[model samples]
Target: MSAIYDRVALIGLGLIAGSMAHAIREGGLAREVVGYARSAETRETAREINLCDRIVDSAAEAVADADLVVLAVPVGAMAAVAADIAPHLKPGATVTDVGSVKQSVIDAVAPHIPQGIHFVPGHPLAGTEHSGPRAGFASLFRNRWWLLTPLPDTDPAAVDRLTDLVRAMGAKTDRMEPAHHDLVLAVTSHAPHLIAFTMVGVADHLRRVTDEEVVQYSAAGFRDFTRIAASDPTMWRDVFLHNKDATLDILGRFTEELFVLQRAIRMGDGQQLFDYFTRTRAIRRGII
Candidate 1:
C-alpha cells in the first residue's frame, strides 16, 4: 500500500510502538516512522534494532512535522505526554493512541490537543505477554481489531486517513463510544487480567506448592494464568487504576458468580457445576 501519512511519530517505544513501526514499514503505511521514548535506554535499544526510520531524543522532536502522532504510553502517563507534545505537534496532525482503556485516556489527553489537531483515541486489541522493543513483530496486528473512539468534533477526514493507515497495516478498524469501550474492555481484558494475577498470587501463597512443583506441574490452567499474570505490570496497573469504575463493576459481578460456584461445589451440586462449565465452554467455542 502507498504511504497513508507522510510521517508518523510514535511517542513511546514499547511493544505496541515497536510493532507499529514494523507494520508501518512492511505495509508502507507511512513514509517515515519516528519514535521517541522517555527512557534513554529504550531509545538506544530502538536505535540498535533500527526499529524506526528515526529515533529522536525528545517527543517534541519526534513529532515535528509529522502528519500523525501515536501515543503508545501507559494510561497513567498519557496526560503528561500529551502536555509535553501539545506545543510541538504540527497543525492538522491526527493524534491517536494504543491505550487499552479509552475514556480515561481521552479525558487525560483531549484537553491538551490544540485547535487544529485532531485527537482520535484508539486501542489495538492485540499484544503478547512479552514487552519492550525486541518483543514486537510486523504481523502482530494482522487480523486484529483496532478500535477508534473519536470525539464529536473530531475531523472526519483525519479519522479516515488514520483508519486507512491502520487497515493498511492489516488490522480491521471499528469505531466505538469512549465510555462504552471502557466497559467492554473491562469485561474482556481488565477483569480477566486481574483474575489471572489473583490466581497466580494464590498459587504463590499456597505453602504446600513448592516453586519447582508449581513450575513443573503448570502444564495446565495455572500455566495459562502465569502467562496472563506475566504481562507488563506497569501497563496493567495503569489500566486498572484509570478504568476504575468499569473494572470494579465487572469484578463485583465476577465475585457474585464466584460465590454461586463456590456454594454449588460446597453443596456437592454436580449438576450445577457441569451446567456452568458447559455454558462457559460454549462461549469459548464461539470465540474460537
Candidate 2:
C-alpha cells in the first residue's frame, strides 16, 4: 500500500471498482483506497464489505487531494461523473477510467481534465456477465489486456506510473488509439454480447411455441449463451448507446455473412459450405 500513490479515489463501486480495490489491496499498490457511489444502498454495501478504507458520500469529497482517481461508472454517465469530480481533483493527479467504449469515454472525459492533470483512459479486457460489488474477484484482471488510450499531450511520466500500477495488478498494458480500441472491442466483445442477447431472446420466444420446458432441456451450448445474456442491462445499454457506430458497423457485416450462409444452406451447396467452414476453422485456430 505504500509503494504507489498516497491515495486512490474510486468514483464508482461496481464490479470493476470492486475488482480494482481487491487487486490494489492484494498488491499493496496504494496507501489508501477511497470510494464513492451514487446510491446510499451501494455505499452502505461497499462499507459493509470493506471494499475501501473510506466511503465518501460525494464524488468531489472522495477525490479531494487524491493522487489517483478512477471513474468506474457506466459509459453514458461518464461525462457527468467527470464534470462532478474535476474541480476537486488534486493538481497533477492521474485520472483513468474502466469503461468499455474507449472513444465515447474519451469524448466524455477529455474536456473535464484540468491543466497539469493527466487523463489516461484505460479499459481492462476482462469481466464476467455479472455486476455490482459482490460479484467481483481479485483475479478478474489477471492475464487480461489493459488498453490505455492516453491523450497526445498527456505526460509520459503519468502514463508510465498508471501503466505500472495496472501491471502490478497482474495485467499487461498496451497503448492504443481510442478509435481503434472501440472498433476492435466492438468486434470481439460487443458483437458477441449482442449475439448472446439475441440468442437468448430467440430461446425465450421458443418457450411460447415450444413450451416452457424448453429451457429445462437446454444443453450446455444454449446454457452458455443464456449466462452471457444475463449480464446487467443498464451497463450494456450504456455500452451500445455510447458505441453505436462501431456496433452497427460490425452488426451489418455479421448480417451480410449470415446471408451468405443462408444462401448456401438453401441451395444445398455443400462445397460452398465446406469452404466456409474450412476458412472459419483456420480463423479459430489463429485466434487460439
Candidate 3:
C-alpha cells in the first residue's frame, strides 16, 4: 500500500501506538512515523526497540509537520495532549484518537483542535489482556473493527483518508455517532471488564477461599476473569471515569438481570434458568 500520510505522529507510545507504528511500517501506510511518550523511560524503551522511525521528546515535536496525528493516550489525558499538540500541528492535518469512549474524547479533544485540522474521534475494538510497548504486535488489528465518530462538519476527504489508512493497517472501518459508540462500547467492553474486576475482587475477599486455592484451582471461567482484570489499570480507570453514564446504565440493566437469575436460582425455577441461558448462548454464538 502507498503512504496515506507523509508523516504520522503517534502521541503515547504504548501498545496501541506501538502496534500502529509496526502496522504502518509493515503496510507502508505512512512515509514517516514519529512517536512520543510522557514517561522518559518509555521513550527510551521505544528508541531501543525502534518502535517508530523517530522517537521524539514531546507531543508538540512529534506532531510538528505531520499530516496525521494520533492521540493514543489515556482518555483522561487526551485534552492535555491535544492542547500541547494543537499549535504544532500542520495546517490541514487530521487528528484522530484510539480512545474507548468517543463522546468524552470528542468533548476533551475537539476544543483544542486547530481551525484547519480535523478532529475525528475513533475507537478500535481490539486488544489483548497484555499492554505496554513490549506487548504490541503488527497483526493486532487484523480483521478488527475500527469505528470513527467524526463530527457532522468534519471534512469528508479527511475521514476517507483515515479510513484508507486504517484499512491498510488491516482493520475494517465504520462510522458511528459518538454517544451511540459510547453505549455500544459500554455493553460490549466496559460492563464486561467491570464485572470481571468485581468477580476477581469477590474471590479475593471470600473468607473460605484462600489466595493460593484461588490461583491453583482456577477454572477457565475464573482464569478468563483474571485475564480481563489484568488489563492496564490506568487505562481502565480513565475509561470507567469518562464513560460513567453509559457504563452505569448498562450496569443497572445487568443488576436487574442478576436479580432475576438469583430469584430463579432461589426458587429452583429450572425452566426459567434454562430459557435465559439458551437465549444468552444464542447471543454468544452470534458473536462467534
Candidate 4:
C-alpha cells in the first residue's frame, strides 16, 4: 500500500506503538514514523533497535508537523500527554489512541485536541504477554480487530483515513460508540484480567501452604491464568481505574455466576454442573 500519512508520531515506545511503527514501515503506510517515551532508557533502546525513523526527546517534539499522532501511553497519562502535544500538532493532523478503554480516553483526550485536528479514539484488540519495544513485530495486528470509537461530531474524512491505515496494516476496522466499546471491553478483557490476577494471587497463597506443590504440579489451566496475569501492570492499573464502573459491573455478574457454580459443586448436582460446563465449552469452541 502507499503511505497513509506523510508523517506519523508515536507518543510511547511500548508494544502497541512499536508494533504500529513496524507495521506502518513494512507496509509502506507512512512516509516517516517518529517515537518518544518518558524513559531515557526506553528511547535509547528504541534507537538501538531502530524502532522508529527518529527517537525524539519529548512528546512536544514528536508530534511536530506529523500527519497522524498515536497516543500509546497509559490511560492515566492520556490527558497530560494530550495537553503536552496539543500545541504542537499539525493543523489537519489526526490524533488517535491505543487505549483499551474508550469512553474515559475520550473524556480525557478530546478536550485537549485543538480545533481542526481530529481525534478518533481507537483500540486494537491485539497484544501478547510480552511488552516493550523489543517485543513488537510487524505482524502483530494481522487479522485482529482494530476498533475505532469516534465521537458523533468527528470528521468523517478523518475517520475514513484512519480506517484505511488500519486496514492497510492487516487489521479489520470497525467503528462503535465510545460507551458501548468500554462495556464490551470490560466483559471481554478487563474482568477476565482481574479474574486471572486474583487466581494467580490465590495460587501464590496456596503455594505457601502446600510447600510449592502448586508450581510443581501446575497444569494448563494455571499456566494460562498466569500468562494472562502477566500483562503490563501499569497499563492494567490505568485500565481498571479509567473503566471502573463497567469493570465493576462485569465483576458483579461474574461473582453471581461463580456462586451458582459453587453451589452446584457443593451439592454434587451432577446434572446442573454438566449443563453449565457444556454451555461454557461451546463458548470456548465458538471463540476458536
TM-score of every candidate? 0.97, 0.97, 0.97, 0.96
Question: Which residue ranges in model 3 land beyond 4 Å of their true spot?
Answer: none
Model 2 pairs whose backbones collide: 1-28
Total clashes for model 4:
0
Q: Please write out the lDDT profile of model 2 over residues 1-288, one tens digit for every residue.
A: 456888999988999999999999887899899999999999999999999989999999999999999999999999999999999999989999999999989998999989988999999999998889787789999999999999898899999999999998999999999999999999999999999999888877773556356568878987888888999999999999988999999999999999999999999999999999999999999999
Report how far residue 53 has shifted in candidate 3, in Å: 0.7
lDDT tens digits, residue span 55-164, model 3: 98988899889999999999999999998888899999999999999999899889999799998888899998877778788999999999999999999999999999
lDDT (Cα atoms) of all candidates against the true structure:
0.93, 0.92, 0.93, 0.93
C-alpha positional error of residue 58 in candidate 3 after TM-score superposition, expressed in Å: 1.4
Best of the two (2, 3) by lDDT: 3
For residue 69, give model 3's deviation from the true position in Å.
Answer: 0.2
Clash number for model 2? Answer: 1
Number of clashing residue pairs in every model? 0, 1, 0, 0
Candidate 2 ranges with C-alpha deviation above 4 Å: 207-213
lDDT of 2: 0.92
